[model samples]
Target: MSDIDLDSARPIFIAECRELLASMESALLRLPQEADKDRRDSVHGIFRAAHTIKGSAGIFGMEDIVSFAHAMESVLDHVRDGVLPIGDDLIALLLACADHLGQLVDSVAENQAQPDAELVHDARPLLAQLNQRLLAVRMQRSPGAGDAPQRKAPAAPRQTGADHWHISLRFGRDVLRFGMDPLSFLNYLQRLGRITTLVTLHGDVPLLDGLDPEACYLGFEVALESSAPLSAIEGTFKFVMDDCEVGILPPGSPVADHLTLMRERARGDPAELQRLRAIWLHCASVAPEALDEIAAAATKPAPAQPVPAPAAQPAAAPAPAPATVRARRTGPRPGEASTVRVDADKLDRLVDLVGELITASASATMAGRGLRSAALQEAHEALALLVQEVRDSALQLRMVKIGATFNRFHRVVYDAARDLGKDIALEISGEDTELDKSLVEKIADPLTHLVRNAMDHGIEPPALRLAAGKPAQGTIRLNAYHHSGSIVIEISDDGAGLSRERIIGRARSQRLLDPGREPSEAEVFALIFEPGFSTADAITSLSGRGVGMDVVKRNITALRGSVSLASRSGQGTTVTVRLPLTLAIINCFLIGVGGSVFVLPMDVVEECIDFIDPGANDYTELRGQVLPFIRLRRLFGVQDTPPRRQSLVVVGHGSQRFGLVVDRLLGETQTVIKPLARLFAHLRGISGSSILGSGEVALILDVAALADITRAAMVSRSPAAAAAEPVHQG
Candidate 1:
């Protein structure tokens, strides 16, 4: 009903596969530090994700894709078992395999008929090594500790006589719903032979009232006549069965004798077997080896020791428990709970519906402002309240935790620091910070650049650090939190801070600064954000490109956010990023500028007060705070005369504070953002616009940008700023 194209499931598969691949890459990179036994979980998670995609591909009959994924999965299985040791070289090979698998998946998803043969050829060498190891191990021993494989193999090769084999399969009580799809194996059997007999067992089927439709209730005793080898039949179920409970008993068995045994076992059910015989006569008999192969698969491995110890005696304590292996044939890893696939577009539609509901409720409240009936008024108020709750609940669905995004920095830091040969440690904090999904998606690029720069430049080389009387291993700390109604992410390095002198030299050499003017330390750091500026001594893949950090600043700005740097020469440098909690709705204080109304975010507003003190008239000595204040009317060239008493609004960022002079302080208003038109894109001081009750638009002031401009102006001591009148209000 979703209108999703079933054939297009490939692209979804590709995306999910890529995410799984990244997870695997990250997990593998962490393995050296992780104890081997503790890695089973990571291995299992990766294996299941791959296995699911492969099975889905098979349903579409994607031959090459299925075969390739199976090969990679075989390698992962070896890693899962204790037989193969995981090491750096093997992990590197697996990583490469993961990447290729992604490409193949993408090719299939995009409806490209075939994947690149070059990729397959490139991967052959590694797959062959894996195969060689598998062959080596298989050749060394038979299944079930010497007996299972030897007996099963000799019988399998000789089973070519008939096309059908009678199979009676009774699964263990614990088999998962699809754990033993007698049908999947049956279908594979049918591929080789014809199904001559089918007897469905209803004994295990529950009373109609108690039955679970999803549960497999019926078992089968089947008779198939086919020419396929016994090995193919055995391999189909190999992934699942510990005890197959199968009997090859193909069509060529002594007719009279087999019938007598079946009659005895059936206890008077003659009709089913009689019907089976009629179908069996038309097809070529199944192979004798097939019968034996089924028997071998059905048998369980014998216990090392079958006797139990006496309750009181320590009876020669058993050897350490071997890692238990329980093989279950499953199409995919079980999910947290059963779920149905849904298109993202549908979810977006639902969100939009909820937004409209909120808008309608607001409209209704406005329309019924003076309703005379008590009952009607109460009804309207309750509906408005319910709609408000619904709006919040809908938006919360798009709120995702930042933990996954934060954890990826571990691998990035590890790989980059090693490439630079600098010993550095990445420390993470506050991964539980929550943000809008859109913001999380947009922020990944900027965060990556900052982390790469820290690893490549901020951290000193190990030997250099030791000689400088510091810890040999430096640390890069990523911490985030919700502060002042905004999300703050801090990436700080406890290595040498920004080299002020070196940065200034690089900027001057690159013609990014005035020829002979001395730049302050802060100014020197700020210059790094100028296009094409970097302080690296040599060009390298990680940092010498000189193309990343500046773009990082610009992108953060575009997010209605701000980023700034704070460093102590030898202490450390921290890049602080402050972003709005949500892009959609914000609470603001309305202020008038040049006859047009604008809004300042309430979170950053410290206080609003009227100044009566005559000392406030001077540009100094207002509450002992020396910071100069800017008036709204004058800054924007508003020519109107000022009101008798002007209100001062104090805004704070960290320890800094400044005042804005406005004609009036309008009460708080809740509004939703409406982006400005593209032509006015360079509107610097105004970040965004929102609609008012009267259908008028008010600009949202960019507080952080304004603060930066104020700081820059104060530092420069511009002649224009000094010439203007100041209220000295703080």
Candidate 2:
């Protein structure tokens, strides 16, 4: 491959290595929880992931990854064979190795020729740990070997004239067509041991005029001198096994096996059989006597018994174990869905084009309405439907399941609980919920902070849990589901819940809350999210400088989302994060205030009503309920005078309801969200901007921020105004 091709392929290799590392870590985590029968499958999966990574890294000439993955694969190989027992210590060591491997892959992503000095230093102990494990396993397997030294002495050199393992390979014609280079496998084989001799055969190659450039018609006979197991040698070709025929003859093997390999390769052609026999005898250094004995035995037919009936034949003979393992590691089974990995930039560009198309479609529709042409209007109505479908399809391509993101918390909870010396288990539900890919990526950090906080602060210690009449092993639950056109993620823990008194006291000491004022449960709980507010008596590594929760709130808010905290005195606490399905475009309820247009996410808008009480402001009675309202004209400082009639759009955010007073109800429309420039980022009550069909820019309202403003406005009202009856607005 050219330098350009290699540069382009490096990202793919890096991405695949990361995915494999993730799979390896997940499998290692599950080892302790799986049953004996199921545990074997997991072990195989982990081994295959490591093996594939090493092979790919070798192809990329990434020596760091290859060496580390090779060491990890050795230990995993023993585990798969039941030589090393599964235990907590082994799993922990392997998880650490997986982490180190991830770091190596990160270096590759950065185009570093090798891991930096710090990473190299970090890898020493991990590699040492792997070597120690393998040494221990070997000691345990050896007969009469007890209390062996930590470091074994080097073995004596191999004697001269020793027989070598002979390997025969004949690649299928389509090998090159599938983007595989035959020499790469041979290079990987060198990692196992020395290849003393290699002979390439081109007997199958046609004349120059008849040859196809893309077809592979070559074979190889290799004399390898190594002590590596047969399985390891076979695994060198695992990725291409389906498209190649491989035969291995170990030293000291019976002559019958060699004869069988030769016959299989030669098929039924006498000339080819003779050619193979001669090559094995001369080139592969096979004994002539052994071949003659095998030939004589094959020529003499043995006495046969009566042939069995068709039904008496064995039904579906078992396949070789190695073949079965390879099958599992290959691509998905028949009838299963396969995926093509696309770059995130490409997906983003596609979404951007779709958004532009939506704007154009809306503009065309508006033009058609002005012309009052029935034919054009009818055609555009159809075009509008098609555009809607295209918009949905384009967005759907970016929608990924949240399960992968949620599963990542398993390791987080595990490590945190271990460090805190607490017994906590993460229980997941509704993991199959789907959300925008962008949201999934951005929400992970916030979710991690929330999870760690729950483990550190929310979940009580084992002794405390027992005293409180709860299970000694506390539980942290991550549940996700879609509701009201939004994805709701709930992270709850069954430990001592948030203490209202403690929170309020902390808030007051920090001057975040007034000393004499009382607040609702929701309001008290929300104080924890205030910057630099903490109820902890002392600082801890995980949290307690009061930095995480505030950032969590800020991040969720920036995503056009809302976070709410609900807790009981002793029951537990649940942090609920609600976010729109996609950030690029949305169905919005457009309203006009003093000739200025604003967009309210359609999901949050409950209903619209005419403002009946013109005399009242800020507070209104909606069907006997005290509904706090914000007048858009006053909020955005629109200079146009209000008309005689105004509209109130009631919207619900989390547990609060607020009404936005506007001058005109524009109904619903599809709005493509365009982010505001950095200069306008500090503006409150507006999350983004959008361009309408009339070429006018409309501000996308931040519903949560507006709700907060409404609450603040209601709280500032005078005692007499508060005591006054709210004007009926229904």
Candidate 3:
């Protein structure tokens, strides 16, 4: 214990604090939705979270966290015990406290031991509210419990000694080496209760030659008179338990407890044993038989073995799993297996190394393609399979369920609804869907904006909703699922949907639309994503001035993803976002456009067809449908004539389909996505570059962006040009 690196433990402490805070928030939110037993359970859960945080913070000597969380814990304890009812105001206050705690925990991560001045100011009023509630409840209960004149009396008035608690503390020899002060814990003990008796012992002190100045060799016995709960009394010494031995006896403990104390302090010294016995005897009277038994045990010549200390408390409990729509068993059963939490950066390094292994494996397979030996080919094939498995396992480490991320919105909806004075309920589904952890983090802000926008603009006011024959309480849905090897997230609201006339009117005013041309509904909806595009008639804190939605689109686009909007006037609106499962690697269909090779995400590639000459028309008929095509050779500015034999690779992104004309189809391959250099970041229709096994570079085409570009080009082309090839549909 003395050699433990306490500083190293800080990171783990901060992480645990974050998880506890999240649980506290969840429990608080549930309180309003639940009732009876469920509500009571929620209150208990909240109490446990606050108590654990306070105790753990004490161990780390984070006084700010300890004090703030202690105040919250007191309020929660009263709520759980039915001294105070759990009401809307109390729930809101607890949520604020949880938020403050989260900020404090983050401060710890920032290497600030104490919370900042602003946090202190915010917390002071919250703490006052909690303490005031506690005092009010106590005052209300006092008259009922203390002034009931007709209540039945006990057998006799309780004795003073019977109401006091006895505490036994023995300092470890190396307590000081652990950076803990034994006296500090004793000082904190007085804050919980009045101390009636205190006696210190130095029996463990060594001879001068053997003594070490840094080592602690002290112990104390104390009698405390108070009405605090046992858990609270035990928590006072939580920080020093690792460096000392502690035993707590409740009021009116048995004579055997005092006898055991005598033997522990004796150390074969009769005078020292008698002093301990006298201390206990003076604090409380004992029966003659009990005294004789204690005397007999103390008189026996005990072996010279040293007394053992009580077991220290366990570290804080691991956080509960994220609240899910359904419950399932998690983690391993006894005797099965266990897990260790690794630093995220280390896991990322491992994933990078695995990616390199994948590239190297592809290189080997390329080298072996020329080998005639069947055995060598078989070996290379087997190696490829193993490498693929390893890559998959490594990637899985970064795939976390989106449920935790989704759960965060509960609080967001709760707070935003209150601020806007709207009755909005957020319904979430498919939360168990998993995505790359990095994507989960980067997507949070964009999702936040979408959620807020939906609550503010998408959901109509309660009165309007009711007048429109809808429920007074509006509903906003966040749903996620995997489609075509990509994750699709939809934020939809049951409110007055986008007004096409208003949007087109606004677009024309902003010159986002052609002067005298009317665009289709799809094209009109797409204009909302353009910068500074909004149909809001007024400005407010949440929306207005055309901001949030455009940013959401940009951020999603930056991730090589796509966003689209669909709405029906007076019905509802849904914003759909599509993103790849992982950014590190993907399966790609390789193709050759003139002298260069290109990769198209395999999930989006529908099929390849012969590139028949459509005679001055870029659009061709495929399966009885007029399909627009973008010639890669021309789009990439490749200085080469079209190949005699070419193929069009038809790809589908979301609801749109388009073709890429290339010299030949190169089939499928595992593509390790290497990001484009900063210099090429602004390049259009190309997301990233990849190194092939043959040491060639292949650019990974952005299918979604290319589809958009093809549609835009068709929209801009002259009517005669687009109609050069007859439009057909099955």
Candidate 4:
């Protein structure tokens, strides 16, 4: 038997640390109030969260975190049973304990067994207060405390059951390097059932030179029969089960199959087969077919079982080893939940290269245009299809649910709202929305600022809300959904709608707006994001410093995304941000301006409209529908002479749409988004570049930026007052 490996134990310590922090964060953010009718459910949730961290830590013998979690869990248990209340004071103490436990877990993960002495000292008063409160509450319980002993504990399972079963197999050396301990399978199996038998497959070991000390040269053929059920057994291998061959071979399987397996093992040695035959007969219950099949297996292959799981993604290069020391082989049978984990960075790098390849392929395909031969034409068509597929795969790799980002904001809302003493709740929607991983990372900070701003300024105090004929508790909602080719995330608060009067007064006083201008509320509210501008009575370090809003706008703009705000006096305020799905390659409907091609991201391109020369169109006929129009020839100043005919590329951002006039419509093409270099990053309406088949570099038009420009132009040319048009419909 192998000894417990300390080196392998380290990863467990690290994982436990991560898990503890997640649990602590999740719990503190969701702590229930004392008067909540469903308080037990809340306390129980906290208990389970702590219990998981403690149990996982216990598996690796990280007693410090486990012990701390135990203390916190005890209080949760009392609260869960209503022996102690879940008041603000208790939640405060428990949250502090959770914080300390996170620190202790981190220390252990970094291999520091002896944490700072003062940490334990700091926890003493909290622990004492916790225990004292639990005791005092228990004493105060009316009759229930005296009757506590009468309650029976939860039922425990029996030691043995018929549904028990086990599987055994030795894996190749390749399996060991993946850091999977063959023994963990046994431990995992035990969780599924009372393991009836475990046998090492010494039959597969090679001689010493062929034996790899670092590699798993031997496998185990295990038999597990359990009543707990088969699904759990399957789930145990859910992560790595595909790496090794797995099947449910019943007891007393075919004797011929066994014999074939044995004969194959014997390798035509008559003496060995004879010995195996005698052992099979002596076993009494060994299947005759198994005995007979072992011989046939030596010459003919054994009957097909499921194939093992494929090695991890992208298949790492095989490490060099002496041929004598062969690695063990493992994988799933033919069909199973067999898969391998791959480093996301590797996938990202591959996608980037594939983008370059698409450009190169497009150029090469275009180069073959002159030949016009049937063979070359066929080859070009095939290459085009292949490149299209590659582009799709690259795009797929960048798609990740917006949920991961949403989950992180829970802690932010919890902590900020608590500090502000607001009974605010954050409701999330459309978390299943997807976006580019890179864009997701950058959008996080801006989202955080928006959420914090809503909590600090947009939402109101509980008492004021109740006085206004509204529920006492305030709500902040974060929602994300697909709109056109972009993802729209909105953070809204049902607080006193942004104070329009206050915003107007502040903008005027700050000289941000001219006096007696009667600026639209949208324009007035936009001033809040101006640097050093805030209408708050007093500034606090948490917010209202006037530093965060500018950063929020700057970050979103850097992403080629836009933020718009809308609010009513009493309804609510909504900050909506629109971001592209992936910042990489895009499916573009290319158009030409003065004969030069330009790609508009397909998601934003609504439809193409053949332009009929405008001859003083009536404002009533097109009043609300005046296509916000931009002239590409004028915007980018293309050199080639413009065609007599022009087409309108109608692009959209939410409900807003605009037409871009170009000389020709170049049809659909797959184009990679190559971000403009730093020197050119500040260019207007040109967000990025994409290469064409002739190696021509086409610019990606930023629809949001173009919309802004067109809107500005429309306003400037308007006969009405400067602030007449509606700007913020948040």
Candidate 5:
């Protein structure tokens, strides 16, 4: 039974451990800038993560994880106690320890009874470093044991006269059956402080015939003398809080606190009330009158009605038990929604169902449009609204903050900076921007490549940056935000920006540049994404291969996204990646070109305007600006004569603008984007196909790709032809 329980809980434990590792890394990364109070909080948080993982690992009997985490927790403990000062060296060592612990957890996840020998061998040096620091702490405390004592300021003394914390614990009957030893918690508590006094109660023990060997029926009243904070003591029993009833009274707590604990503990048993009073009188400095009042209240018949909740306090006292403290840690104090840990597969299944619901709703709406009855149309309209709401909610389930992905680059920048002997600082902004989870995962590798490339090739050495009147430390900024119904991620660096001369040189050498005509600045910048294109003067491990940039463009395009590069010679370089919010389903403007239907993602559709001439010219004047337009019929090689009354669908892709001339506007649609099969994946200006309510296939137009095609066409035309009034023969 124990084995079965452990197996059932292993996955949850692993998931929590991974979260703890991420949080630990984040705290360590921010340690350098934290203030004194913030630093203490950060250290304590790091300790809790390690301690929780250690305790949970011990429960699963993963000794490799427990042993290493125990050591890491010890070092964090010393740091928390102010015995060890935090520094870059210490933080580095701790980060390394975190990595090793992650490896141990991964080993367990791989079904290994023990960690790999190579990993264990690597951990030895880190363990030694940790223990050496711990040993130094102990020696420093011992009188006359070291040459010079380098000690931190003394911790604040306990506030009141009392010095012993009062702890009350009642082990649940299932504790023993759950493989938890009551005495083990006692031993762990000792690590925080000395237990000055203990009173064990066995009143709950059953008769001989009723006793169960595996059941636990013990309680303890302990007086612990220590300077540890209330949070630290509460953390001792955090794992078992749900399984057992636990209460803690801080040193010098008010008599009211003890009274509260007694009332809670003595709910039904009169003997239990007397026993608790006896223990409280022995451990606390409360007067006999307070105990008499509590005893008197315990004996009085409880009110027949349930007690009302206490009113809110302007300045409430801290909670004493681990359970209460854990609640406060988990969520906000008020109006917080209860959350459950749902499996990702479950959420994905819900999204798939929602997609189907949207499709069906569209079909019903289409059917209703053909009906002559207004009542039927109204009903269908209501249903459509409900389905749209459901779809939004479903998509939101898969929208995750990009903070995790952004923070991951901290380590990348750190390692790359060290490897290149450069001083680079990463500044992350808009981390809370939410996007589709699938796009987040797919964009990670490409973003990583771009970030490293910027650091390696775009950013100059620190000396050069200083000479350029910039700060000694180069800065790389990662910014994300929502723009026009899409998520835009920008990776910008305050470094020596892209060199136009060098880029053009490389493009010319690669035969990517047309010698007959000069390219626009945008065209020159776009050359960087050409396959096998690079401007690096020499081959280096990071960037000279020229493979990553082109691949980045391709991958982003695969997601129906676009990547644009902007740079100035001496200012900086910024690579902007624009991606759809969700690829599963979209609201599109369906248009017809010849006999084929096309869907333009509504988010990019600026407006639809009357087309004065279908084929008289390739550019149109919209307001005062020359809007370059692409003829869909010509672009797709439609053999049919163009419709006499065509319409232009104005679309914007980042800063570039273009128009698409269509045969007819089919109005708005709810579309589920279906990826093209491999045989047709190479089709230009089309991302995927969608099935409309009429059972016709509509090619979902790639606005970014079409904008690119427009730009390319403009570049191929003569200057006069590219002008606003140029005439072209079909």
Candidate 6:
């Protein structure tokens, strides 16, 4: 067989291993709370994850991962068999093992053949603990199993008279084409048991002239002397079972069963059947008298007997058929969708191409409109619709559920609660909300900081909570939802809320607020996000450093998002973060201000009205409520005369409504957002730039930033105007 490219498969192995590890960790965390039957299933699931990891690692020759996972699998097996009880201590140990395995997988991803010396050294104590646990259990089962001298003795094989398991392997013809080596599978199988007898079958092979080098035609009949269970032996071929035929019989089966297996393989072909029988007798050491017993039984079936019901079967009856046979016959369940893993870079490229398509379609539509031809305009209109659909589809490819990201915090909360000696529980909702994959990755750090801060600085101790007429366990809730074309995530805690008095006092001490001027509660709470701001009485490893919250704000703002705070003094604090669904392409309302085109996100545009009271500085009355507005002419210094009739576009961000005064109100269009250069990075009220159909670059307005600017502008003008402005309960 041709040598398989191990490098090409390493990434898949690493990704699968990480997913399995995540599931295992999640199961470990929730095992304590699950119902009895569900708890048992969870244990089995964890064991399967470890076993699959070990088997896959063996196929790739990752001996370090294989050995470590094997030890972990052994411990989990005892748990699965009810020989070991589940407890907090056991769960903590298993979590550590999962983490170590994750580190090992990361090492493999970094192209290391084995874990580093330090990592190997780290595994020593963990392995010792696992061995001790196993030893303790074994000693409990057998009184003499734990003698000092006998403890070092190897485990004895299961008591099957011959201790031989017969495995039949018939690999598909395309196995080699798919980069699998049959010999490698056999080599891995050797790790489980000794193969005493092996016979190769070449009956399926074609003539020399007709042979294909890439086609796999060889088959093997193996007699393995193993103490391992049937499932363990079957797991060796788990990865290739879909493309290979595998039949495994436990040790000490009747000779008639061997004949039946031979008949099934031959499929009524006399010559092939006889050939297989001969191999079984001579090569596998089956006695010849067994063939006569099988023939007599087959020919002497005259008595009629009623079939026994499944529930009536005796407990000592033989086990059911192996999973391999059932799986081959059943196939996939109806309506089960298949999935393919594509590199993230590929999806990004596809989105980039779609962006270009949108730009090209816009240019074409502009040309068609200039010509004023009905046919050309109609065709371009259809093309525009099609292009819009393509853009949506392409962007959808990058949209993934936020649940995976949220679930990761379970471990984070578990570890942090233990370290802090607090009773904190995390409650999550709206986890199925979807957002851009890029945002998901970049948002993790900010979310992590927020969660840790909530745990360390927000949640009160159990005693404190109990004294305050609250439950002993403080809860941190993470909720997400989509609103106005943006994803809103809320991180809240049921602890003593932000101390308004202390915050104002800290702000005054830090010169962040006026000493004599009393700011609103919102303003006071906002000061906590400023650099080097903290109200903790003492410094702690998790939060009192006062270094992370500022970074969180900066990161979210960098993603063209906004963060706001709400607190109830003695209740709790909720920090709400709002971000666009995608950063690549967006639907925008185009407008002109003194020959400069500006784009407003379509989802944020409430309505457009005639620019009334042109002389109004920055505030105006709209339908009885005071509306704050910003003039693009003054904001960007556009040197052009104002039109006789201008327009005001009302935009709503969160609960705040604002207006952008423009010279002309152009219609809506799809826009591909391009980041501004470093020279313009500091520009306020503008997020990014886009190319219009006429080839003119238009700036995409940053509505959240503009809202802040409007608020500050109003406050600076006069305190009376600021008080008259409506309070936005964001």
Across 1-730, the per-residue lDDT of candidate 1 in tens digits comes to 0125534555565666677767877777677677655587677656655665566555555666677777767667666655567776677677667767877767665654556666667777767866876666567665556311111212122333433465555554433322234555565455455665565566777798997654555555665656655665555455446534444454344332233333333445455445433323322243332333223322333224432322432233232221112333444445636455556566556666765565566556556765566777788889867765776776666667888788888778766876788888888899989987778989998999998888777888899899889999999999999988789999999877887778877888899889888876668778878898877878877887788888999999888888888887777889999898777666678876556788888888978888443452323335545555566676667887777887777776544567677787777755666678888678777788866655567788878777776666666675554444242232
Report how far off residue 473 is in candidate 5 (Å).
1.3
Q: Which sections of candidate 1 miss by over 4 Å?
A: 1-5, 8-16, 108-384, 470-472, 515-518, 611-628, 717-730
Best by lDDT: 6
TM of each candidate vs. truth: 0.70, 0.79, 0.76, 0.67, 0.85, 0.82
Residue 80 shift from truth in candidate 4, angstroms: 6.3
lDDT of 2 at 89: 86
lDDT of 6 by residue, 1-730 (tens): 2225666777888899899999999999999889988998788789878877887787676788888988998788678667889998899999999999999888877754666667867998899989999888887875655322111111332222334677788988877655466875675465566766667788889999999977899998876767877777777776677787887766545554555566567666666766675566533423344544434433343225422323422234354343333224245446957678999999999999998898999999999999999999999999999999999999999999999999999999999999999988999999999999999999999999999999998889999999999999999999999999999999999889888899988888888887698776667878989998999888887888768888999999989999988888668989999999999999999999887899999999999999886375688878877788888898999987888888989889999888888998889999899999989989998899999888999999999899888766766767676777673532
**How does candidate 6 score on lDDT?**
0.81
Least accurate 10 contiguous residues by lDDT in model 1: 147-156
- Top candidate (TM-score): 5
Candidate 3 wrong stretches, greater than 4 Å: 1-4, 143-337, 371-373, 713-730
Per-prediction CA RMSD (Å)? 11.5, 8.1, 9.0, 12.1, 6.3, 6.9
Which 10-residue window in model 4 sums to the lowest lDDT? Answer: 319-328
- Model 5: lDDT equals 0.80
Query: Model 6 — TM-score against the truth?
Result: 0.82
Better of 2 and 5 by TM-score: 5
Error of 2 at 539 (Å): 2.0
lDDT of 3 by residue, 547-606 (tens): 878888888987889999899988899999999999888878999988889998889988
**Weakest ten-residue segment in model 2 by summed lDDT:** 319-328
Worst-scoring 10-residue span by lDDT in model 6: 148-157
Candidate 5's TM-score reads 0.85
Model 3 scores a C-alpha lDDT of 0.78
lDDT sort, best first = 6, 5, 2, 3, 4, 1
> lDDT (0-100) at residue 713 of candidate 3?
73
Residue pairs in candidate 6 whose N, alpha carbon or C atoms collide under 3 angstroms: none
